[model samples]
Target: MASVTYILFVSSVVQAQEQANIEKLGVERVNPADVKAAEDIADQILTKMAEGSYYEFKEGEAIPEIVQLFTKDTQKQAYQQIKAQVGEYLSSLEFQEAYSLSQGGMEATIFRFKGDFSKSEPEVRVVLDRDDKLAGLRVLPWTDQL
Candidate 1:
């Protein structure tokens, strides 16, 4: 019984330490340049998406590969869904945070933003690949209440 209790206590402490280390690492891995580039891409994408003109950038205006990631149907569906839930876009996005990570020999940067819409504020995450092209974009319902 005593041995079990000691093991449980040590395990809990180790877990706590690991979590703290992860938080520290996240803070240390941020790159301001990467964050800025990712933010620029995210702003452009969000603006176009909200305006229902995503396809307009397909003809050599933006990164073709990144633009192709979301098909026309998917973009339309996502645009409609966001409009229905969040109403019209209110203002430019506010940057929240960013982090950098290595993935399969490539470096990736993820920037998070608070998007202000007419109805609700959503959290938008944009990931940029090593080539500074958008690799992933996700808009999640805001959980933080002001």
Candidate 2:
């Protein structure tokens, strides 16, 4: 029992540390064009979600890259949940910031955006891998602290 408890605690700490690292965003330098491109990708995605019937993915107005398979499925479910919570999707307000993080020798750029919907506003994050592929996407309620 004692060993199991210790292992669980250690695993939790490791997960916390990983999240902390992402929050820190050590890299200071970022390309302006890259940020713009990332923002565009994020915008395209949200726009599609807003327009697509039943929250399905739209065909046109997408970045020319592959979104992660898991992300696509997960995003569909998550988007549905968000739609239920926030009502219909409207328009995204603005792009916030983009930052890069490296893990296991691979680097990914994460971009933030402020989103607008019928019922609520949310903050969105889009992650693009080194090859400019969509790696991850998340939407959360807006918080002042970010």
Candidate 3:
């Protein structure tokens, strides 16, 4: 079982209430199987975006349908933004860590990869909800923290 964990977000988007809830996460451990399943979904989505496909992510595999918080256009925009900042997505790093987090009323697992791009290597974060839905996903400026 995963131990109780707390996350502190200093981002401008996070408000006091949300931060409070986020700090309360970490009561149970998520199954490794769940992590793998979620990662597979994240990989598929990221791969498409990285390849500049900009297609719908929930393609053919509709069994465990993923309801993402972001829309198709949003996904495209985010990835495009990342691509613009970093350049083409040459490949994902050879090895990276996946993070599991639960806070407030949200529980999710994330996979962060050092994306090798044409000009830079930025951090790509993918988050999936406990129900295996897409909770959040984004590409952020590179940070060595993870």
Candidate 4:
């Protein structure tokens, strides 16, 4: 009986720690307007990439400053790599959360999404600058196996 009680206490503490870690990441609910804008931009970009129209984003779709960070060639290569590894797009994208961070006096919002690919489900993060331009983007494999 005492062992059972101890186990329950330990489980609760572990759950609280996990919640705290998530909060430390700055994840929080964002305004509905911001969520809509970010989702629209992210979805548009992802859709285009899935359709093999990588070069089209070189225009107004993405900010030139941020695009230079990855370079056009590198961006195309990354897209191809994802396509090869993840197969084709499966279209199960759902907004997960958003976080705000400041760097060099500029504020950026990170929008996260749990998206389905042909091979696996990955978390997609799209960072937008104050002007609503893409500042950074990344796709990482996500799993509950942890």
Candidate 5:
């Protein structure tokens, strides 16, 4: 009975997120003449993120499948659950710095955030498609020791 309620809640959230993604991406045609425009679109999206307003653009909803790469699916409820755990960890600490890297043809941005959690910094990577849509996300609480 309790499990059924939990499942229903999660399913509702996923369906809501999927709808939000469709609206956020919208329906637009891209072409050579729109190259700069496309870049602008990406820049606008990233800039908004940098400003610390991170959430689904469609309002009152979570971003959809920010971890699709690891799951190989368009929607990943498991990924969303893992992400919430990581987000909680970050939110619990007093963060000091945020560093970002986008290199070597990887359509992803890796952000390192230092916080009171430990001497080890937590990191997040967001991969985006050519249309500037989110493809996936990875969160690491600490750097792997070699």
Candidate 6:
């Protein structure tokens, strides 16, 4: 019984250490390289929308499953509101600029998209895990004069 307890405790410690390592290694660098990579993503989104309606970027593994689920449920409504203001999907839009780079225990990239002046400002937020990899993106609903 003593040996079994010791083994379990060791195993738990190893597992926790491994998780910490993964988080440390995965935390993507917050530099121009990362910013450009994200810009590439925004560019791809534009290209797909220009090509056709069925375009989608490949999913990043860093993104959590629950976040994906939420996106699935609310994407349509969220996009509808944004499209009404922005003129199309994420394509045909420019990353006006990053309004803020707020870092909490988890960091976020908050940016504004340039759309029609007549419409309300449409914004997108990308949440990152401890390692700085994208965990999910949230598109706010439209607040224009519908």
Query: For this target, which candidate reaches the highest TM-score against the unseen true structure?
Result: 4
- Residue-wise C-alpha lDDT for candidate 2, range 1-146, written one tens digit per residue: 01110100112222233553354343356666666766776666666656652223335322333322324555556557667766565765576766655655556666766768777667666666676655555666766543
Cα error, candidate 6, residue 44 (Å): 3.1
Tell me, what's the RMSD of every candidate?
12.3, 8.9, 8.3, 12.0, 14.6, 15.1
Model 1 Cα lDDT, one tens digit per residue, 1-146: 01110100112222233332212125557776777776776676667777777643435333454455566666667767677776666656877776554533545555777878777777766666557766566666754421
Task: Give the Å error, residue 39, model 6.
Answer: 2.0
List, residue by residue over 11-126, the lDDT tens digit for candidate 3: 22222334433332232544556556655655676677676565464543322323333446656776776656777766455325665565566555555556576877666555
What is the per-residue lDDT of model 5 for residues 17-79, given as tens digits with 9 covering 90 to 100? 333222111124323223333233323333333344332343311224432222222123433
Whole-model lDDT per candidate = 0.57, 0.54, 0.52, 0.57, 0.30, 0.37
Q: 80, model 1: CA deviation in Å? A: 0.5
* Candidate 5: worst-modelled 10 consecutive residues by lDDT: 1-10
Superposing every Cα of model 6 onto the true structure, what RMSD results? Answer: 15.1
Which ranges of candidate 1 are over 4 A from the true structure?
Answer: 1-29, 55-65, 143-146
State residue 90's C-alpha deviation in candidate 2, in Å.
Answer: 1.7
Query: What TM-score should be assigned to candidate 4?
Result: 0.66
Q: Backbone clashes per model, in order?
A: 0, 0, 3, 0, 1, 3
Q: Model 5's lDDT to the true fold?
A: 0.30
Query: Candidate 1: worst 10 consecutive residues by lDDT?
Result: 1-10
Q: Which scores greater on lDDT, model 3 or model 6?
A: 3
Off by over 4 Å in 6: 1-30, 46-62, 65-67, 70-74, 89-104, 108-124, 136-146
Where model 5 places Cα greater than 4 Å from the true spot, the runs are 1-87, 90-121, 144-146
Give me the runs in candidate 4 sitting further than 4 Å from their true place: 1-29, 55-61, 69-72, 143-146
If both were scored by lDDT, which would come out higher, candidate 5 or candidate 6?
6
Determine the C-alpha RMSD for candidate 4 after optimal superposition of all C-alphas: 12.0
Q: What is the lDDT of residue 99 in candidate 6?
A: 26
